[model samples]
Target: MKKACFCGTFDPVTQGHLDLIQRATRLFDEVVVVIGVNSDKHTMFPLDQRKKWLEESLKDLCHVTVQARAGLATEICKEIKANVLIRGVRNGVDLEYEKNMAAMNHLLDPSIETVILLASEDKMHCSSSNVREFLRYNRDVSQMVPACVAKDLKEGGKA
Candidate 1:
């Protein structure tokens, strides 16, 4: 079915993520947006909140679904029977990092291929970390994240 999986911490899904997922939907029949649960890394938002934000952001994409997994993304891809891994790169540094991860994922599972998508020009600077930083200072993130997320952040009084 040419299914693809895109995995990220998604502490808060940003517009860049939405751009990549939207682009991925055009290429793959099914795209699974996975929120990777890392026990060692602390996140600004809880897992359920992150999942809900992702779901709200991607509700219009019929062929896409949101899920949460507590292991390697490559393993999750295999478990979900996805044949492609979708990654988004904003610049050289991100490209290098994604390249290494893709290489390691290939070593782990040679059958699944990784597809790297460049972030949209407008969203190149948007990221979950940056959004969190803005929230920390009570800065407006309405332009960086989805409307639903922005509304939630404002209503929650995260700062």
Candidate 2:
């Protein structure tokens, strides 16, 4: 059985993230969504709230497991015995960053491999930050986010 890890902040699990997760689930037997927290970074949604959102977002995906972490992804992969690191790329700039990071991950472990997936056109423009921006501006973001997310945003559900 193939196992992989998807690492990110997931401040709010947008449709884009769900797209990637859905795709990853097809190629791997078990895909764990690793929510990493970086103290130096700032996010509109707190980690706990985001984690809760992710949990609800993935409650239906039996093959997908969501968990929170506080450090490097490379370490988590090693600890979990995962050989694949799945990432989603939206465009050229994203490819550049993801390509370099894939190379670095190889150097860090020499055993783990990074896999980059291009998002579908609809999801390419959707991101957590974008969703947050729309919400912050009081704009309708029902199209860019998942149903659960939209409900959360509407019913005062955190992140």
lDDT of 1: 0.93
**Per-residue lDDT tens digits of candidate 2, residues 49-140?**
78887888788888888888876778899888788999999999999999999988888887888989999998898987888888787887
RMSD list, candidates in order = 0.9, 1.7
Lowest lDDT 10-mer window, candidate 1?
150-159
Query: lDDT per model, in order?
Result: 0.93, 0.86
lDDT of 1 by residue, 1-159 (tens): 899999999879999999999999999999999999899999988999999999999999989999999899889999999999999999999999999999999999999999999999999989988998888888888999999998887788863
TM-score of model 2 (CA atoms): 0.94
- Whole-structure CA lDDT of model 2: 0.86
Poorest stretch of ten by lDDT in candidate 2: 150-159
CA shift of 110, model 1, Å? 0.7
Model 1 ranges with Cα > 4 A deviation: none
